[model samples]
Target: MGLLAFKDAVHLVSRTGLGAEWDMIKQLEGRSQEDAVNWVLHSAASGLRPTPRMTPWLKLEPMRLNDMKTRNSAWSISQREGKLLQAWWVEQMLATHTPFIERMTLFWHNHFTSSIQKTLQPSLLYQQNLLLRRHATGNFAELLRAMARDPAMLVYLDGYQNTKSQPNENFARELLELFTIGRGQYRESDVKAAAKAFTGWGVDNNTGKFIIRPEEHASDSVTFLGKTGRFTGDDIIKILLEHPRTAERLTEKFWLEFVSNRPDPALVSVWAQQLRKSHYDIQRFMRTLLTSEPFWALQNRGTLVKSPVELVIGTLRTLPYPRESTQELLNLCRLLGQELFDPPNVKGWSGGEHWISTQTLLVRNAYLSKLSRGDLNDKSAAGVKLPNASEEQLVEWLLPVKPLQPLPTTPGARRLVRSLLLDPAFQVS
Candidate 1:
């Protein structure tokens, strides 16, 4: 096994969680790989914080609106609540000790995607975010079960529309294609059967909880994935969990998110077997993957494009900022093509290289430049006295990995910080 050097520790921290500051990396220096991985994971688990409670706008009761004026008022309120929820999550990411918890929560969010754009209910989205955080690193099976019945998910995927007489296949199809087994692993017939199995699985609007309508449920036998029975939604989840492809797909997703964009089939196979053996224990799977030989490979270091949220939140966490700058930070993330609770589609944001575009790159550079100069509204870089440090030290402190080329000649702390932030290497994790 490769020794976990300072660089390896830095790489582990950057990839496993959101980016870490220099002090966080320094604290892990000289530690054994297993010990370091264990500490980061345990810290994240132990330091878990509860999400903020739902606000009044988010908790409004469902009501029938007969007039456009009342509906417009409700829409405006929902919009405000959505923005607040996004800012609140950004704040949590900035303050959390266990970044991996938030990072994994994000991964699961993308995996089991629910969009407020379709649901139009900020409270449902907030509730689903809490659900994702609660089971962020828990059992995959249980999480899948919870997701099947989540209020936001039901609304986003048309689960609420599914009934015995007319079953909707949106949730079931996504459950197979995007969530569990990848495309082409399951047949169209399987999707229909799974849809039938999930009939009457919906949310109770008044209570904001999952409620099964027995009268609307299809209790008739449905053959799915070669199993013929009166399978319910829970049964469908069990079958998917038992399938080998489910583990393989999840392992591939983990690799794509944390390891590399280009997955090695051999490495994925090794981890997939472990995941199956562990019965989809996410924490164990993540710990083992982080401490593995492949993860410590030098070539894999600094290879991923930082997603917008990671780029913004990671940068903010490294710098000092006014508490009131949360909205500005959220706006920056949105401008960079990532808005919390508003994934572009069912597939979610196609991260990696897709995070960068000609337009978005300019936005990223401008935001970083402003942030470095303390020009963002009500925000200033107060932490980490960069002016006192040499350029070499500044590079090390601000970036996750060493730059391939020498930094440009720059004077003043703010200028030097801007140069480092705009470095090509900083674009990647």
Candidate 2:
């Protein structure tokens, strides 16, 4: 790869991973291609963080609405779930030295967006996140199936209520249109057929468990994708995962999210071919693309924008903000359109360019400015231990990049902090 191209590659990894900490970028500064690839994969030991404990129940339980207690309970549960999701993501953001694994996990979350609003349980969302993290770098065929029958998913997509007499087509339609083959790749008739096959596929009411009631399931034969037979939702998923269109759509989505925002059709084809050939080994697929010539191209670097979570968590990690200063930072996240488990919609936040709007940009500046105002101290104990970065001996620690030519006293320090926050480089990796 060319020099600038490699720099761009580093940038891509940084932007896609957690925003680059100097130590990580330095390690890959002059490394060989293979070394860089190995380094990223081995960056974390599964790197998954503990689930957050905040739930809708916790948030609303204090209110204790006599009549709407269920509603309050649900909200509290969602808040905890939301906190768990955010905490989990933030841990990955801070701890994982590699960029691609985190990037892939972020991609999968969007592709299979699940809402605690519908699932009504933090456990469900936690379980789903676990599935995404575990299979994120694995086979798509298996990944797709696991997501389809997920208890959380069953409730989120209304698949659990599907019955033979009145089959709900929501799951079938989204499965084909959004999740797999996508629109125009399959026909309306196929969706209808798929829905029929999935009837009586739902979760249990009493224990809130997965229940595949055979009697409620449609018994009649159905035609899907030119094949006529008694196919269930599982069969439809199996068929779809095996379709060429599935490979095409999945590759396109992955490329746009990870490799490039402006995905070249040819580049996507390259990945799709590899994916199909490898039976959709996720990490292998990512590894292939990361090592590809087109992926390291200069045009792909710094061209894409960072999302809210990325911007917030990235700044937090690189700056190594004190742990005591974590709460307000979370509040900033809420203001920036990406509130952890609470994605704006089923589609999730349409990140990319939207993450850096006027309002959110202002908030970002404010966040950094506040960091300058605090002293890195331990509140509980006298002459307590400092945060991770107390010594200012290192060049990076001593030198906070500032815009003004000559750094000043108090005012200058604040301006320096503001400038660091405003630096375009801070906006990305």
Q: Among these predicted structures, which one has the highest TM-score? A: 1
Per-residue lDDT for 1-429 in model 2, tens only?
533223443454464466655556556767776667666765664555654654432344334335687667666666666665666666666666555666677778888877766666666777777788777777788988888878778878889878888888888898898888888888888988999998887766555556789999887998899888889778888788778888888888777665667777876777787788888888787777777775666556555566766666665555555543345556778898776555666667777778878988888767666654544232333322223432222213222222323333443333344444556645543
Query: What local lDDT does model 2 show for residue 123?
Result: 65
TM-score for candidate 1, residues paired by index = 0.91
Q: List, in order, the clash count of every candidate structure.
A: 0, 17
In candidate 1, residue 220 scores what lDDT? 93
lDDT, residue 364, candidate 2: 73
On lDDT, the leading prediction is: 1
What TM-scores do the predictions have?
0.91, 0.81
In model 1, how large is the Cα lDDT of residue 81? 76
- Which pairs of residues collide in candidate 1? none
User: Model 1, range 1-429, lDDT digits (tens) per residue?
Assistant: 444556666677788777756677777878888888887877735353455455342255342144767666667667787887887788788878778888988998888887756776788888788889899888898898998989889988999989999999999999999988878788999999999999988877567788999999999997898999999999998989888889998998888888888888987888888898898999899887887767777777677899998888887766553333888888888889888899999999999999999999999888776666553232234553433556766676656578756655645566666677878788886
